[model samples]
Target: MDMYIRVKRSKSTYFIRCKPSDKIIGIKQKLEEIIDQPVSDQRFVLPGTGEILEHIKTLADQKVDSDAVVALTLRKDVNEFEEVNIVGPNDFYQSRDADDANW
Candidate 1:
């Protein structure tokens, strides 16, 4: 029950994968900690849509028993730091390789 998350914007992207059993709030918190910022202070994205859990429902209906890929990205441009923190020109976690080893 792992999840793949992509936090990005026009210029950058940060890809993160975690167990779905891990709370989304926790993931947000961890990313904030990694970037030295707060979750609310950053942009909130839910993959294909801004609405969270859509990925869950979409996959569930398809009977896909695989990890969820939730791409969280900013719809508009944010400030430089905010962009860098959330999604900037230098996001270091892009094109991440999937690691099922955690499971």
Candidate 2:
């Protein structure tokens, strides 16, 4: 079976490196077109919990390809940026920028 994956950054999307793939952009664009929504919606459920990993739209002029696992990072209220709070089964590690460094 062919596996489909996406790793979204800030505003740009990094497509996973899947074999038998002619081009990543083709699939990405097709998916985007089909979804009629940003790739951010492509989320997966955290095992054992009800947490979801939502992809953020990445910037353009960037390179993203397959093999990149876009993980679901925890989100904080726009109001609170210091106080840490866990969201569902995110296994969320408090990060000032969600860059893997958990406080």
Question: Which candidate's TM-score is highest?
Answer: 1
Residue 34 local lDDT, model 1: 69
Give me the candidate number with maximum lDDT. Answer: 1
Instruction: Kindly list the per-residue Cα lDDT of model 2 for residues 37-97, writing each as its tens digit.
Output: 4443333333334334323323111222334344322224433222222243334345467
TM-score of 1: 0.44
Instruction: Please provide, for model 1 over 6-90, each residue's C-alpha lDDT reduced to its tens digit, 9 standing for 90 to 100.
Output: 6554545556666545555666667776666665555444444444432223334433234433444332445422222233434
Judge candidate 1 at residue 70 and give its lDDT: 43
Candidate 1, which segments miss by more than 4 Å at Cα?
52-103
Q: Which run of 10 residues does model 1 get worst, by summed lDDT?
A: 80-89
Q: Which regions of candidate 2 are displaced past 4 Å?
A: 7-20, 37-88, 91-103
For each candidate, how many residue pairs have backbone atoms clashing (under 3 Å)? 2, 12
